[model samples]
Target chain A: MLRGICLEVPPGALVRIEGGNGGGKSTLLRLVAGIDAPTEGRVGGRPPRTAYVPERFPVALPLTALSYLTHLGRVHGLGRAEAARRAAHWLDRFGAAGHARTPMAELSKGTSQKVAVVQALLAGPDLLVLDEAWTGLDARARSELDLAVAERTAAGAAVVFVDHDPARLAGVSDAHYRVEGTGLAPVAPVAPVVPAVAPGSRVRIRAAAAPGSVLPPGLSGRPGPDGAVVLTVDAARSDEVLRTLLGARPPWHVRTVEELP
Target chain B: MTALLRYQGALLLRSQRWLAPFVAYAAFVAVGIRPGDPVLDSLGYAAAGLVPLAAWLVRICVTNEPGAARDCAAAAAGPVRVHAAALLTGLAGALLTGALAAAAALLVCDRAATGPGAAAVAGALVTVVCALTGSAVGALSGRPLVRRRGYGILAAALGSLLALVLAPSPARGAVSALVSGARSGTAEVPLTALAVALALAAATGTAACLAAARRG
Candidate 1:
């Protein structure tokens, strides 16, 4: 039970909640999302439109992904035509268009998560609460979600999220807090990495490819200032990306594939 | 409220939350009624047996309160409105069941001048009462009993049975009076009993709101 907790999510802010297992992170998100009330505390100034994505999707419901999303959109007060449109848009954005017609129970875990996340964003809520929403997404879907979060914050929607990875939203979150004991305490932001070798156990590679040639779907990084492009892949998938880069008809010239310190 | 109604209608349809209750209602009507039987007796017996099933439906709707849906609704509509939506859903369920009962009455009962018509109307009202009361009982006991799904359903069923027993004019003195051909002429409902049912409904609604509030 959370007690004496005080929270203020400023408009347009991206707030990251950090804590270990059983540290009350989910409970905090639920309270903030208004899913539950605190035993003793006042939640002042709740915005009119709010959306929440829970950690677990209730997939046993007898609804197709599109129907579920449309139902939620309507719940948020959108017209049927508009709700249907938004549902399609978000499903396509998350690369789950095929599963839109599939029953929620039949979708893969990753697809189900995509549906869960898209439903929260369809109405463009003033406050969005997400609890471990990124856990089961593919790399491309993850990046799409990252971009969506940035877009929402840019459009002045406050976002509260909990992701296991510490680097999930590095350099983007406006505020961070740790849930401990019974309440929230501010976390000092970590300094940015501005070195040639970035921090982490990620596999980083530099390759020479034609300018503006799109990187593979699962890799994330930047285009270069000169000829070589830099990208990072999850250590588990490093070999997969490397083979794709080397085995292309017009193969990309590989420079380095070193483990980040 | 309109938006909530539409959304809820969609959920009820696609999720098929109505299947169990509707099936139970239909089965009760179909199996119990025979041609040339007194409409009231058949209906009353069917309704009595239906109490537990209807209460189970209400209990499922009000309790457990799907975490994802509740979270989404809490942020948008607030807990008060969410409970209101649940109340609305319950009412709609009652009305639908009432309509179905009316249709059954029309199908089974003979074309009498006035008695059958009155009986049909009475059947509809009792149907609503049974539904609303069962829904109310579910709301009253659900939050406390949610984890024990079997117990919650049983409690709702028992509570609803108790309410029904007290409801008939003994309350159905109102319902039975409507039946057997309104022997005296004017039909007078036991206002005190109705007041009790409505009050229970209101109290259960309030409890549902408090449950949402204390869910943390």
Candidate 2:
């Protein structure tokens, strides 16, 4: 049975799912992939246009990378020749051209995993579900995978990947979550920030802060000894709360909290 | 359904990995034959060729990804009937190929002195029986509860027992009379045995196909 689990991912978000082994991480992905049924609670969403790479990559029999991917393309409604060409392109991209004609059984586990990855990517799924997809790869392969994911997300695709090593995905993810006993809880957003304004100009904002609403914590409209309110925010709520305050009507001409010197 | 059949058939044929052993064994049977009673020789060739073919087909039909099975079911591909039909079609094609080769060999060798017509008919019958039995056995292999190696051994044992009990006697008079189409004494034995084999094959094939369709 799936225990308390909840998650909400915005479109085009690069979300990382993390959990201990046997924590239903892969099971969650399978349920999302429509490969398994949940015992009790409902999983709500439109049937996703998705590319799911399972923990154990499943390769179809008797078909070469080209042929198998081409078949998958056809299954997704691409023309046969078009599918073949795209498949060939992906194989070459993955450095799998030398073994393009090899049957899946003959390929090493890593090679097969690459084929599985490419197959999913070629589908251009709206939601990409990758379960432990980062396992078994050299640094170079991992970099290639990161690049592929970046390209897909740049084109506005939502990607959800399960990974045991968070550092491997450091630069790639926009958001991270830990799957606990119940559901997913936001761990943090991971993005490098550039200071846009000085610290004294930064401001604090509170929850339920709406457009045109005055900034809370006595920082609205009051000038300090230095001249501006020099908004100071509690660090915990600074990211989301400050962004909301700055984006409100009248548009605060203040620097973000991090910009404060 | 047509699309599924084409997809399945193409995969099975192209894999070559699965079909290679069966082909090799069939070749071995063709090469191993020596002169004997025409009917008995044909029967022996048919039985020998069928054993490996059944084993291979069973393995192919059962070893599929559980995830893929779930996906296929979710996609509204109808029930197991369509899948079973496709698998059976594949097995039938393989059987036909083997039967044709065996019949051609019999015709060329004329070792049985039974003429091409009788040899061809017997080969076809034997091929059908074997194919059906293989398909049935393969369907059973797909069950999670059954161990494939154990199932294979059991099927082989059962088949050998049936062959031993039903095999024609080696007596020259009986064998010659059966081959010569002389209906005086013991015509009923061979005919009854063939009928029972055919019936068993048909029943098992149908059952296997049905079971596969439902489970798949």
Candidate 3:
């Protein structure tokens, strides 16, 4: 039971909720999402289009991912065609497009979580509430979801989330609160941390490809001196970029890997 | 509301949970109404069976979704609309099943004694009234009120029984009107009972929907 809990989330703001396990974090998020009515207090100013993603989406529903997302899109007030389009778009964006027709009951945990996230984004809701929504996602999908959250906030939507990862969207949240025993308390925002090199450091890779061999799909690089191609990518993704180049037919020869200062 | 209804209807249809109550209703009709039973009598028996079936369907619809999915839907639509959609879908399913059962009774029962037209009208009215009353029973006995599965089922069964046997229950009154009409060779429309059932259903639905958000 929560009492004397007063919180306000404005449009375009990202609010982070922090609390210990079973400390009413989920309950607070539920009230904010209008999933549950407050017993003694009131939650006002909720937008009409709201979406929520639960912490554990362990549903083995009868519908397929695409069908379930389409239904949710319509529930969020989109037309039939628009709902289907958005459902497919979001599914593809999250790298779950291949599983669109797969029955929900047969989906793996991470894929089901992807579908849950896709359903929330399909309608472009004005308010998005996420309770441990990123738990089971892969690193790629986790980053994709981070980007999606950024896009939603940029589009003037309010986002409230509770995640166990301390670095999840750290320093970017506009507001922060901690759920205490029976009420909410405002917590100071975490200071943005700056490394010697900016957090998203880049790597420059020089590779020589066979003549007349087309570059791998989705790989873009500039021609370097002496016929070598120069590719710049985030340090975190340099491995994947290298793997893609080497994994191609008649693999490209790596010349050098230099850290971008 | 339309979208919510559609979503809930899809859940009920695709889940195939409707089959249990449906088959039960069908079994009740097949076993009770023989080839030569009186038209009104068969219909009364068929309609009586629907009360419990309707309540069962409502419980199924309300609880069909896993808790997380229900929360997702509740966030998209309000909790009240979602709850109301579940209740309405169950009622709609019950009404559809009742119609089919009534039709089957009309086809097989001895309708010469009570005119087919009178039997048809009375049967349809009682079917509607009983379904409505049964839905009300379901709304009250479902999730928010009775959280435990064992107790919720007990409450629904007991509630349906009371709805059918109570002296002032609209379902009871309507079914009795059909039975008395069968004996007197006259058609009596249970308009008053219908109104009462409609009101009861609306009140129960509103209460359950409101409580869903408050009590969740």
lDDT of 1 by residue, B100-187 (tens): 6656655775434346555665565555555556667667656533546677666776676676566342224334544544334332
Q: Model 3: residues >4 Å from true position, as ranges? A: A194-261
TM-score of model 2 (CA atoms): 0.57
The per-model DockQ list reads 0.54, 0.13, 0.66
Docking quality tier of model 3: medium
Judging by lDDT against the true structure, name the best candidate. 3
True contacts kept of each: 0.65, 0.12, 0.83
Error of 1 at A127 (Å): 0.4
Model 2, DockQ value? 0.13
Worst 10 residues of 1 chain B by lDDT: B181-190
TM-score result, candidate 3 = 0.86
Residue pairs that clash (backbone atoms under 3 angstroms), model 1:
B167-B171, B168-B171, B168-B172, B168-B173, B169-B172, B169-B173
Off by over 4 Å in 1: A193-261, B37-50, B63-66, B110-121, B143-145, B166-192
- For model 3, how does the per-residue alpha-carbon lDDT over A84-151 read when each residue is reduced to its tens digit? 99999998999999999999999999999999999999899999999999999997999999999999
lDDT digits (tens) for residues A129-177 of candidate 1: 9999998999899999999999999999999999998878878999999
Residue A209, candidate 3: alpha-carbon lDDT = 77
Looking at candidate 3 chain A, the ten consecutive residues that score lowest on lDDT are: A190-199
Error of 2 at B166 (Å): 10
* Best-fitting candidate, scored by DockQ: 3
